[model samples]
Target: MRQFYVYILAKHRHGALYVGVTNDLIRRVHEHREGLAPGFTKRYGVKLLVYFEQHATAATAIQREKTMKRWPRAWKIRTIERTNPTWADLYEEICR
Candidate 1:
C-alpha cells in the first residue's frame, strides 16, 4: 500500500508549530529547516520534527494534518509529547 505521513515541526524545543502531510518526512523536514521549502513553515521557522503519524493513504494523512493544524497550541503540544516526551530532534529517530 502507498503510505502517507502527517507530521508536525516546531522551531526549537517549543517555538513555533507547523502541520503538514508528505510521503517523505525526512526530506520535507530538511527542506523546511534549510528554508528550501517556502511558505509559513519557513516564515515561522518551524523546523524541528516533533510529531508524526503514518497512514495507509494520502487521503487519511491529509485529514489528519488538517485536524492537527486546527488544534490549539496546548493540544498540539500534548499530542506531540504523548509519543515524544521531550519533543526531541526526531529527524534521526524517524529515519532510524
Candidate 2:
C-alpha cells in the first residue's frame, strides 16, 4: 500500500506554522528538523511535527496541503490544538 501525508510543522506552541505534503512523513520531517530542507521551514525553525493526516493518494494529500496553507492562522492553530493540545512534537510518536 502507498500513502501520502499532509502535515503541519511549527516553531513552537502557537508559533510559526508550515504546511506540506510528502510520501515519506518521517524522512521529510527529519529533513526539516535537521535544517536540510533549505527554505521557509528551515529559516523559520518550523521543525516540530505538530499535526498530520494520511491520504491514500498524492493528489488528495497535495490538495489538503494547499488548502491548509491558505487557512487562517487561528484556524490552523485550532486544528493543531484539537489533535495535539500541547502542540507536542510528534516525530517520536510517528517513529514508533
Candidate 3:
C-alpha cells in the first residue's frame, strides 16, 4: 500500500505554520529542516514537524492539506497541540 502525508511544520510554539502534502514524509521534513525546501517554509524558518496525518491515497492527503491551509490559526494550533503539546521535532521519531 502507498502512503501520503499531510503535515504541518512550525518555527516555534505559536509561531508561523506551514501545511503541505508529500509521499515521502521523512525526506520532505528533512528538506524543510535543512532549509533545502524553497519558498515560505524556508523564508519563515518553519522547520519543526508539529503535526501530521497519513492517508492511503494522494488525493486524500492533498485534500487534507488544502483543508488545513484554510483553517484558522487557532484551529491549527489546537490540532498541533493535540498531538505535540511540546512541539517536539518529530523527525527523529520518524527516522527511528
Candidate 4:
C-alpha cells in the first residue's frame, strides 16, 4: 500500500519548527538535513526530525499536517513527546 507522512522538524534548541507532508519520509528528511531542499526549513536550519505520523492515504496525511500546523506550541510539543520523549532524531527509528 502507498503511504504518506506528516512530519515535524526542528532546529537545535527548538530554534524553529517546520511541518510538512511527504510520500517518502526518509528522502524528504534527508533533503532537509543535507540542505538540499530549499525554502523555510533550510533558511532556519530545521534539520532534526522530531515527529512524524504515517497514513495509508495522502489525504489523511495532509489533514493531519494541517491540524498540526494549527496546534499551539505546547500542544504540538506534547504530541511530539507522546512518542518521542527526548525529542530525539526519529529519522533512524522510523526509517528502521
Which lDDT values do the candidates have, in the order given? Answer: 0.87, 0.94, 0.93, 0.88
Name the lDDT value of residue 6 in candidate 4: 93
Task: Flag the better candidate by lDDT, 3 or 4.
Answer: 3
Residue 82 error for model 1, in Å?
0.8
Model 4 misses residue 34 by how many Å? 0.6
Residue lDDT tens for model 4, 1-96 = 889999989895345888899999999999999999999988888899998888999899999999989999888787877887888888888678
Worst 10 residues of 1 by lDDT: 10-19
Candidate order (TM-score)? 2, 3, 4, 1
**TM-score, cand. 2:** 0.98
Can you write out model 1's per-residue Cα lDDT over 60-96, one digit (the tens) per residue? 8998888888889999988988999988989988778
Residue 5 in candidate 4 has what lDDT? 91
Q: Residue by residue across 1-96, what tens digits does model 2's lDDT show?
A: 999999999999988899999999999999999999999998898999999999999899988998999989999999999999999999999999
Error of 3 at 19 (Å): 0.5
| Candidate 3 per-residue C-alpha lDDT over 1-96 given as tens digits, one digit per residue, 9 for 90 to 100 | 989999999999998999999999999999999899999999999998988899999998998899989999999999999989999988889999
Q: Give the TM-score of candidate 3.
A: 0.97
Which has the higher lDDT value, candidate number 2 or candidate number 3? 2
Worst 10 residues of 4 by lDDT: 10-19
The number of the candidate with the highest lDDT is 2
* Count of backbone collisions within predicted model 3: 0
TM-score of each: 0.91, 0.98, 0.97, 0.92
